[model samples]
Target: MYVAVKGGEQAIARSLELLAEARRGDVAVPALELAQIREQLRLGVARVMQEGSLYDEELAALAIRQAAGDMLEAIFLLRAYRTTLPRFGYSQPLDTTAMRVRRRVSGTFKDIPGGQVLGPTYDYTQRLLDFDARQPAQVACADAPLPANMPRVLDLLDAEALIEPIEPGNDPEPIDLTREPLTFPADRAARLQNLARGDEGFLLGMAYSTQRGYAESHPFAGEIRMGEVDVWVCPEELGFAIEIGSITLTECQMINQFQGGNGVPPQFTRGYGLAMGEGERKAMAMALVDRALRCDELAESNDAPAQNQEFVLSHSDSVEASGFVQHLKLPHYVDFQAELSLLRTLAARHHEDTDDTPLCKHGGARP
Candidate 1:
């Protein structure tokens, strides 16, 4: 009645066939085109691009389709693909102040210069499902052309020295996390890069924990902006920087009031987060967590989960988390057998001790 399972090759082949069929749903219906997904499901594509660490909408859309709409899986696919590609060169530091603003808003102020433009957002829409999405509808385009460049609200504060000024200079370059192993006491750039590709849900949970008296950061979202910024890179031979390309980025600045300690005066501190694509939620969450992790630098009490940099950054990736968790399903008979033997020995010893008669009773019976 009991037979060892065989034909693993056949089983694997069948599973692949089934997966391909499922990914391609109905033969009669045309396949979900990559361009369609990129344009129509732009938000989903954006999420994939943000977490995937690759700013390619078309590839992100394809990964989404291949992964059957699982965002994390799509991210994994994109990351894997990105690893195979050769690195040409590094891009120049983006000028966010000159970003072609699509959507910009500031939570700290009532109104600021370069007035807030809430472009193409679902923020106001009620979360109701529309049953009449049979075909996409076209709306008439606006007659007026948008501005080419928009100044950041922070720059206004920077001019007055109301905000902490970040001096622009060539800081030490960061090590690539993909190529190099992560070490403790990481710099801000490296930490930010890790958090950008981090799992949104995990980071969000950790960020929420801080709000609930964990790290206890009184954070105000100073500003959150989404738009395209030109990436420029200066090759050693070029002698000057040139525009490489433009990338969509979401940047978040968090202001946390820290009564200064550690020989520093009280000042409004800053936490920053920037992502490669339109990822407002992730960027915002990352900013909060980033500030929390900098407790030591800010002289704030480091007593929360988010404040533990090693713990937070190390476990933020879903791909790593998922792989380690699911690896338990693989064969562990040897370890299981070892545990079983130990339990059996303990049980046998217990039984023998319970069954033993008193030595006095045995001597009396003999007498």
Candidate 2:
């Protein structure tokens, strides 16, 4: 049996009107331009693209504007738009090692090939409010031209047989998570893909948990690189791969100590993360969660929340989480009425049964 609620249309219309008014409050102030958001709030755009699994900056910016500055809503809009596009072809696996080195840093090495090129970072910026009406723009020029190519820090450790080796040729064909439903015991590629789009705050908290003795992890930022990487696609007619422009990316390689088990010698283990645009925090947090999720493969204890893939991946999406949590505000009168009726029936039955019974010493009624 179903009974539809009434008067929701007027409420929804009024709510939408209120939202529009709120979104463009006070016509005196200039409306936010899409280009402004694209240029100034690039990090926010990058986050939307990464989570939405779409790389179009312009569309992301538009989505951001339409979402009224709500990042999660922007991500949802982008993701919904992504579903309408037809699949052309899958791009080749990106080679982050060949990134046109920009901001490269390593915590384990004091001096590496790139010499800790902190190209653009807020590490040294003082958290102070600016009082000046007009702020001066920074003028930066590279000092002692950076090396065109820098060796990955983990590769250096691999050369000396200090870290567990990743056989380049033996990787399994990655499952297309976008097409297939994600299941338990996911492969490394699937896990990486899932984490790549996982909610930033959620993954950040999970990563922080690992650092706080949740998973017994002692991880180091072996390398955190931000640069441009070329995208390639192979066409059936061409029989060869062609470059499809390049996009900026941030890659994080976390190195964690691993005690040998499962017939493998003790060595440093690796966790990889790659994100669209300059998303170092996302990359780093993904790396940490990646390492934590590999507890079983690395022969470590799986007693932490990060290690639970079902729990982590299920709640990782902003769109799904927001829908579920926000849906609580919707009308539930019918369901509530059903529960109320059941409670009344139970009370009546209980009263009938106890009507002829005497009061117990401990209480007024029993059963």
Candidate 3:
């Protein structure tokens, strides 16, 4: 193989230089600052952070800049960096009910306890390109401040026992997916963790499949909220939890109709999703796929690709998938040469066998 040749090292070094040159583009253009990416390309940073399984905005922005706007490469960079950091004590589970609401909406209800607060969304705007994006825009202010906390719509259903309750402590103690190997028949905690870090586009397609009858999970957006949620952690010596920090989060709670099965009465089930930053689409897609993966647990028929845990989880990470696919670009000289030799030998043997056979009319080989 060429790798065993003397010039292999020099070739790799030259390739690296070419890659660096290409990544920078024309030197006349100004380089993107980390803050610029963090502020302007926030949704891209959010996706990198979510898929990277890390929450640092600055690092995510840096990764994006380093990858030259390639999202999968940025995710790979961040994930590589994340593995080197030392492990710290885990933070306590977040309480979303206490989230300081910024954007809240419910597809299931037109008017709810908290009137729909549409904060900074593109849904109402025209899809036309803005030629004057660089110009400063006039802004409007609300007459009064929004309430600090709003009740979750799903809780209303839970009040009447119409929906299944999801109490935190009921599940098994969660393990860090990065530190341990994933085992089959994964619990909800592990599955949710996997989906939280899954590729958004992949989950989005899978979710869409469910709506198209691949896995019929008749779903309604019970609530979709985006805001800052306080993070708390407890030290062993303190014996009580204290506020560490707050992080922007988007949460989606999906209400799905479930008929009676496995000795359970007919009721509305739940599919939950949470993502870092304002990732409404990612969160919603995650919720749909999360519900689909729970077919076995919910005693529903597992007949769809989305419902298959092994297939989904194994290919969800963009970093892993990209590496497996992109590795094909690497040197495979030896392997290709062996295949070429085999094909030529087969061709030669076919010609030798047919040469001795008599050709009848119509140029056909006779037995």
Total backbone collisions for each predicted model: 2, 0, 0
Full-model lDDT, candidate 3: 0.92
Assess the local accuracy of residue 333 in candidate 1 as a C-alpha lDDT between 0 and 100: 84
- How big is the positional error of residue 212 in model 2, measured in Å on the Cα after superposition? 0.9
Tens digits of lDDT, candidate 3, 175-268: 7899998889898889999999999999999999999999859999999999999999999899999998999999999999999777788899
- Point out the worst 10-residue segment of candidate 2 by lDDT: 1-10
State which candidate has the highest TM-score: 3
- Model 2 earns a TM-score of 0.92
Model 1, 144-225: lDDT tens per residue? 6557776666676667755566777757888988889889998888888899889889999988998888985888878888
TM-scores, all candidates, are 0.89, 0.92, 0.93
List the candidate 2 regions with Cα displacement exceeding 4 Å.
1-6, 133-136, 348-367
Candidate 2 per-residue C-alpha lDDT over 1-367 given as tens digits, one digit per residue, 9 for 90 to 100? 2222346666788999999899898999999988889988899999999999999999999999888989999999999999999998999888888899889999999988768888877777786766762576677777677777788888889899999888876888888777898998888889999989989999999999999988968999999999989999999999999998999999999999988877898899987888999899999999999988888877678889988888888888878899899999987889999999999999889978878666788977666
TM-score for model 1?
A: 0.89
Alpha-carbon local distance difference test for all models: 0.83, 0.89, 0.92
What TM-score quantifies how close candidate 3 is to the native fold? 0.93
User: Quick one: ranking by TM-score, best first?
Assistant: 3, 2, 1
